[model samples]
Target: MIKGAITGLGKMGISHAAILGAHPEVEMVAVCDASSLVLNAFNKFSSVKTYTDFEKMVESEKPEFVVIATPTKYHYPMVKYALERGVHVFCEKPFTLTASQGEELTELANQKGLVNQVGFHNHFIGTFRELKRLLSQNVLGEVFHFSGESYGPVVTKEKGGTWRSNPEEGGGCLYDYASHVINLIQEIIGRPEKIDGALLKSFYSKGVEDAVYSLLRLDNGLSGTLLVNWSDETYRKMSTSLTVQGKNGKIICDATEVKIYLKKAVPSEKLEKGWTIKYITDLALPVGFYLRGEEYSAQIDYFVDCISNGRKSEYNTFEQAAYTDKVIEMIVNHSKTN
Candidate 1:
């Protein structure tokens, strides 16, 4: 079995623990967190060793791979430490605070030939995956425009301060929410070459933005608008969707379904000339374990499989995530200038 450890016992961290624990080829060895209350429960209920210090847990357990689910502020140092020790890593999203930090870690991981993956779980979602496939086949030929959007109740009302309210600590809707959509756009469509305009608006938070609006141009010259708002009370939870229009047709995709409108029928794909819908049930692949979503478990399984097979994954690599970081930087800079 591949020995693994985890740092941070927050929502994402605990979720990772449950999924990795249930993985047939993975053995949970240790966990590190700053919460004594959480650690005390683990001590009583689980056999895995626990520690408050991440480096200490890594040194003592010597796990082959470690899941870094801590906040974005801790990512650079933690990922650097793990890669230096020749251990594989699976880290949560918004890879790093700056593009430079992400670039450094990407280079280090590549030099060490270690398996590394970021938690951009949307890529594992069935609907989005189908969207990527159809685009690859040029089903929507000569794309002209696109839009990526996400809305959630992360900060609906003004509240007391927390890590999320601090920009230095990777707080803000841009990092926490928009990063997901930006990564999706960069991967599914093309890398954005410039930020035409941007606006970071603050609604409830005093120090950070609750919404983001931007116009971006891709390397392929495809222009698009990004609209994200975390303070929208209408959304019980986060919802992200994408729409692309091309000469041949258009595609609208979200977590649950993908709707296509083709100007002409393609017998090869069995798609009709009009609207056709594909649900997640038909596209999602079965996994050994299920958690918040199959995408979560699917991402973990993909990382573990890459390590065991001595190969690198093309999806959600540190390099791809760094490009996402660069785009975020562009938006921030552009917003300030505007």
Candidate 2:
């Protein structure tokens, strides 16, 4: 069995720990968190060794892989700690506070020949996979432009000086919320070559931005734009959707479904071609202990598979996350300058 440890006991961290503990091929060797309460709570359900110090646990547990689910600022050091000790790492997104640190960790992961992943799990959802498949089949036929929106109620009121509202610690909706949508944008159209009319606005947060807007020119000929608003109370929950329009068809996606409409129907027997649709229900993927979706288990399964084979992930790699960071920086810089 592959040995693994998890650090941090936040919502996402707890979810990861549960999935790790349940994984048939993995032994949840240890867990680390700064809080005694967190440790005690986790220990109640798990008999795994627990430590308040991350390096202490790393030394004793000697985990084959480590999942870093702490806040954005802690990502670089924790990932560095695991990589330096020759451990594969799966880290939550916004890879680092800055593009430079992202580049450094990505390089270190590569040099160590370690499997590295960032927690951009939306792509693992089956609806997106179907959309990507259709895109590859030339269903879109020379895609011309795309636009996306990531909206939520995260910062609608006073945050009371949390790390997420502080810019220095990678706090803000840009990193915590927009990163997922930006990663999706890159997956659809690749990295943006130019950012135009960029705007980052702060609402309830101290100095951090709660909303972002910008137009983009991709490295390819495709054009794109994004609007990420986390302070909007209108959103009941988090919603991220992208609409890709092309010569022959258009693909639109929200959290759980993809809708495609073809101007000229493809000569396929299965698809109606006018508006073929796919839903999360269509995948019928098995869910584990988590209520979020199967994406977490799917991602974890993929990570363990990569570790077993001594390989890397094609999606959500450190390099790809770093690219997303670079784009984020561009937006930040643009917002600052203009």
Candidate 3:
């Protein structure tokens, strides 16, 4: 079994710990957080050694792997500490606040020959895997345009002051939420060549962008757009839809479902049709289709498998994380200017 420790017992940390504990191939060895209240809450249910200092936990438990679910600002230092100890790492998304930090960490992990995985749970979903297979098979031929949106309300303290509301803490809808969309886009279409973005701070704390929209041009000549907001009154919604046009057919994958429209001619008897719109039912995602927890569990399983079997993990690598950071930097810079 792969012995593991988790730091930062906030929502994400607790979730990772639970998933790891449930996995048959993993043994949860320790849990840590700077907050005594959080540590005490976790200790009530878990017998794992709890500590306020992450390095102390690592020194005592000597777990083979560590999960860094701390806030964005602390990610760099914590990950560096773990890597220097020769421990494998599984870090949350937006791995570091900047591209440079991500690149350095990636280099360090490579030099140490350590297994490093970043949490981008959507990549592990069955729906996304199917989409990848279809793309590989040219089902989404000559992909022309793609768009994604992830919008929800601010998850901050009721008193309105929280780390999530501070730009220095890497807080913003674009960085906190859109990282998932950006990561998924990287998976589907590779990195963008140039990006232009606009950010808006409406209905949230001052100086923090609660909404963002970006346009990206890919090297493949394809264009993409992303809309992420924390002020959307609509129910929590995350959707990524791509439209691809080819000589043979057009393919569309919206949310969790897929559709292919062939361009073959119809019978002469039915040739009187003029641009008939067929609502493709196969492209509709079923209710309660995408389960977030299932994706999280799959990611944990893949991380454990990579550590135990010496297999390559499809989880986000350090290079990918760095690229993501660069994209984020561009977005933030553009937001400030325009």
Candidate 4:
């Protein structure tokens, strides 16, 4: 079994620890956090060793893999340290504070030939994979435009205190959530040739933007729009939907479900004055085509599979994560100038 260590014991970190601890192929050897209180609590639930210092945990446990679930600002240094020690790494989303840092780390990992995976779990969902397959099959012929959004209330309501509400700490809806949306778009339609965007800091007490919107132009003559915000008072909702206009058919996909509409009419169907709607279910859709799973668990399992089998990973690595960082930078910069 591969030995694993987790750093940080906050919500994301604790979740990663629990998932890795339960996996049969992994042994949760050690956990580290700056807070003794958090470390003590985790020690009570499992036999894994605990440490208040990450360096101590790494020195003592000597784990084959390390999960860096700390805040975004800490990711670069921590990942660099782990890579230097020859340990495989699986880090949380928004891999680093800047695209340059992300690129440096990606190069280091490649040089060391280490297994590194970033946490963009939405890509693993059956629905998304099927959507990719359909797009590749030209089911959504001649892609035109697409849009996506992820909105919710500020996770922490305090003033200038929450890490997510601070720009220095990589807080904001764009880096935290929109990164996923952007990554998905990149995968489906490829990278954008130019990006224009706007940001608003209306809701949060902090100066960080709570809402962001961007319009992108792809090299293939396709355009896309994205809106992500943390100011919504409604239920926590994340929807990644795309509508592709094609010659033969149109494909629409969202978190809830997927549908494909053929533009051509059937011979037996009568013409209608208004728009006609037809729904068809096909075997092409994967079974259990829903978005409900412990994403952290799936991410870790994929990383482990990559290490053990020498297989290529489907998840984003430092290179893709860095590209995402660059896109985000462009969006934020555009937002400022506009």
Cα displacement (Å) at residue 89, model 2:
0.3
Best-to-worst ranking by lDDT: 1, 2, 4, 3
TM-score for each model: 0.99, 0.96, 0.86, 0.88
- lDDT (Cα, 0-100) at 337 in candidate 1: 85
Report the number of clashing residue pairs per model.
0, 0, 0, 0
lDDT of each: 0.95, 0.86, 0.74, 0.75
Superior candidate under lDDT, 2 versus 3 = 2
Candidate that would win on TM-score: 1
Model 1: weakest 10-residue lDDT segment is: 156-165
> In candidate 2, how many Å is residue 129 off?
1.2
Give the per-residue lDDT digits (tens) of candidate 2, residues 247-292.
Answer: 9878898768888898887775256658877788885356554547
Model 4 lowest lDDT segment of ten: 282-291
Model 1: colliding residue pairs:
none
Ordered from best to worst TM-score, the candidate numbers read 1, 2, 4, 3
Worst 10 residues of 2 by lDDT: 283-292
Reference-based lDDT, residue 207, model 2: 85
